[model samples]
Target: MQPFWNFPATAGGTINSINNAGIETFRGNELDSLTREICQNSLDAVKDEEQPVIVEFKQFQISRNQFPQRDELVNAFNKCESTWKSKNTKIEQFVEQAKYILKNDQIPFLRISDFNTKGLEGARTGELGTPWSSLVREAGSSNKGDSSGGSFGIGKSAPFANSKLRTLFYSSYDITDYQSHIGVANIMSFEERPGFNTLGTGYFTDSHNSTAISNLLNLDPSFQRDETGTDIYVTAFEPKENWVEAIRNSVIYNFFITIWQDKLVVKIEDETISHENIGTLISKLDDDKEEYCQVKAYFKLLTSEEGIQVPYPAKRYKKIGEFKEGEATLYIMKGEDLNRRVLMTRKAGMRLFEQNRISGSISFTGILIIHGTHMNQVFKKMENPAHTEWEPNRYEEAPSEAKKAFSDLRKFIRETVQQQFQAETTETMDAFGVSDFLPDTTQVAGEGDEKKESLTMKIKSIAHKKKEKPKKKVKKKQQKENFEDTLEEVGITPEGDQAGHSNDDRNEGEGLGGGTGNQQGEQGPADEGTGGAKEGKGEKEKNKPIDVDTRYICLEKDSGLYRLNIKPEKKFEKGKLEFKVSGEQSDYILPVITVTSNDIEITSIDKNVVRFVNLTGKKPKNIQVQVDYEQYCVLEVDLYEI
Candidate 1:
């Protein structure tokens, strides 16, 4: 019979040290980090057959007798509980739960498995580089190759931290070896016994001297699955309420890129999570939240070329500014859907930094995927234990090759972002008609070839001129007359004042006589009003027809509809009003305008000109028009009074 446990005395304090070694690096979401870590490990373990990796999570109940060394495990748990003197509530709670699970007939266990990949293979007791040695024996070993997602090997601690008892069993089958290996390891916070040289580490196996696991003996039937791959059984598993949903969301959000690429398949029990149905899964979450929107936007941007490509320096032999051509896809999002920092990732598709110093507006959320052959090595050395960010000091003090490469990359990213910000700001300002009020800051084409004054100098010159100008005071009546004159020059008739005449002056001739001053009792024009002809300057001006230029009309597209705001250059009294639309295309769909105001009524609709009559018998107010069209177009309006 095998000994119940074999605790190693040499690796003392390893459990506490590794358990506390920056496991809290992932500050976003614990389940998200776990999903990312597990998937990354499985992806890294893919076989050369080009088969897609399959990962699964399941929870089941098993009896204590299901373990091969059930009797010894129970006794060990009892002894550890009795000797534990720590007052920590978490430790005490964990010990109590461990004891109850061992004492009970049936206990819960969480099984995380991966298939269609090269299982943990290689020598079990030899030097590093082998999967068994790297995972089971060593800490902080760099067994993964450059292409592999993991390097420090501390990712294995995730499962242990998740387990209540910090106890988990490993089962793997390597097709090349034609043998299956099963082992159980428990990392306890307290010492097992006194003067026993136990380091709170133990393994369940038949041979006490060997660290390799050949079989689970009696428990083989219940624990073993198919031919190859690895199955991790976490004993005394601590699961939160609705853990399945939590895990599902995490897998979808963090590993959607991998799944979308068809490189990985994740399943939680019978429910398979793939890119095809991820939208449905996301719908179950709060779709209005920023996190959900960010995920949606990420997928949308990834599939399409909707982002900027930033090229950085990639050199071969440590040459400064000798670019070898490597590009990063930068997606600048709208609104504060995510953190206002640059999300940096490499070829593995795993997000490395949630917050990088890409200073900008909080309304901007972005993801930057750095792509190149040499980036892995460059980032590997700079990654901290938490895997959150690159060490700033390392980049500052590194060799010339690394320093220059990193510096150039940072410079390119910052400058690209700055340029994008400037462009977006300019676009928004133009949309709001800010340029009409301020001096145009747009750089003229071909101006780069000529020597020009700096913007600062021009601004200073303008300010100096303004300061030297004299201030004058004018009468109120004179100012009103000047404004009306300016309006007339632009073909626009002021509303309250008509050609320098006030409302009282314009209505003076009205109601003066009951009818026209005709010597003989005769009817004037049949269309004339009962008040008769005023013959004032306002009446003469009102009788004359006015033409307006529709070129100033603006078309704004919004949510499958175009809103047209028409600002006619001039106003006219009751007459035939014609609106001529210029720049109409063959495929352009004219929008049906619904009159939102009772003051205007549509007379006739032609191909390009929409004739409408102002019911108030005065100048028409600004018209608001809406239309649904497949394409966004701008149409110039030309108003004519016939």
Candidate 2:
């Protein structure tokens, strides 16, 4: 049993096929998947907390002869071809591509190396839970700890997926001073002789146990692992022209938080992405062309000092993992075009996904960073292999704990956002999934309790108390006139304020309740028309400007379709809606498909606008507008009399 490419005979005699599910899982994703998985693994092996772990991605070309054990691998491919001949199945097609690699004089290889990290550990220990074994030997299970980035070992197949020959080499010099290198080929199961079938997987090792060759690999003249790190050589690699940029974009997309915190550094070809250069790099990216379109906004929210940084207590939530009592921080940044999404991240700085379940009417961006070890472990267990999403059901230990932890997380975040960032009413709760949190206004009050106004109730114009002669303008009063519709409408009144509240100038919400004199409100003053001027007697009062508050609620009809519920303020008869998409630099470039109202006659105006020529007074209207973008968007609506 020499150290050679060995695919043991399928002694179990199970006939195998060419399809490697793990490899296929990563093959379709291309470099994005490759960068995400590899960088995550590199991040998990951080050797020093004080310094950032650096991962470099570079492409190299070498002579075909340099591929060790090349003859044996080619022979295996030929044998595989003959085993599945005449049917012209997938095995035949795979063999043809494998042969094409060896047919060329030059071999293209992508050599990915990482530094400032605990290279693959436990190479010589011949252990079950070693990093080397988890990658090369194990497939379904992982050796990652509770706080590591990845849980499934299937990520090891990403390198092979990128290789045209479906082969790759792994070499590591662990911090423990043990060095080893091995090659793995995931090809079709083939025949060694007339009737001898072997397993589809084969390894290039120095011994029979499939352990890596001890310190004997220099596949490329440019590759040298002098420091305590790992080097991966993706053999027969054929990558696209923008592979470097693609990989860099993926790194920023998936691990921006890690890079921003200086926990990780990435080098794609000549570009170096560190904490100091994070903003500059993010600024240059084309948001339209990138998958992590919100990366730029997210980075700004992370570094900005203006946002609210809330310390949420974890003890209030149900137990996850050890269930520590430490707290997590939730950042809230408000702006006009943030689109209102809170990205969820663990201590490792890898963002799991966006949490849009929290409902609000304001435009804001947020980041939920969980730094406690117990909570981090909990989230880690809930993440899929890509770590793009967190599913509590994935937590195998206790199903109820996972669900409870997830529920508690949403409750804490929603309550915090509703109390702080929410400006006026939850009526226009544009954010999805928080409908359950709202109070049902349809229910009647109990027999004893008088039916007071609910906070979510739409405010109607209240008749002002008539003053006798207005006291001849005795001391001009101060107030805010009518509060024209804007992002900030009014603050929520305290529950106690709702009871025994006056309908006179003391009205805090300004609820269209007529004001005859100066009255102070906790959120400022509610005044009359035109800069709080006192309404003059006689015909002068007729010149007062009409206070029209136009607000619309958005609901998702499908992927790109949004249904808007808007009520005209009784005065206007008809209007048009200018639909500008929510984008960076306030681009306002929404690709609108078609806008229609079931009862109203609507027509598309352009790529970002629509017009309805007919309307009824004070009637709530539903406009089904389909856009080319993802979800709910901030819009510019114009109402007019027809």
**Candidate 2 segments whose C-alpha is farther than 4 A from its true place:** 289-293, 316-322, 325-327, 424-560, 563-642
lDDT of 2 by residue, 296-409 (tens): 778888888878888877364434445554457988888876746789988777767888735535568789988886777777888887777888888888768888887887
Candidate 2 displacement at residue 139 in angstroms: 1.5
RMSD of candidate 1 to true structure, Å: 20.8
Q: Which residue pairs clash within candidate 1?
A: 550-637
| Colliding pairs, model 2 | 480-527
| Cα lDDT over the full model 2 | 0.69
| Tens digits of per-residue lDDT for model 1, 1-642 | 544566556435443422345244543355556677788888878875365688998888777777557666666666556555464555556567777777788777778888887777863443467887787667677587665677777787677666656667777776555344445554454455554435556676556653556642223334556656777777776666577888888787676667776777888978998767766675566777766666776665555455555555445544322434664555665444444455667656665765444442323556666655456656665666556666645543455666655665565655565566533333333357766777555677777744444455334443334545333222122122233244455453212111110111111111110111112211211111111122232442122333331211223344323223232334544332222122422111243444344556666443333446665544435455544443444442323342
For model 2, state the Cα shift of residue 525 in Å. Answer: 40
> Over all chains combined, what TM-score does candidate 1 have?
0.59
Please report how far candidate 1 places residue 579 from its true position, in Å: 47
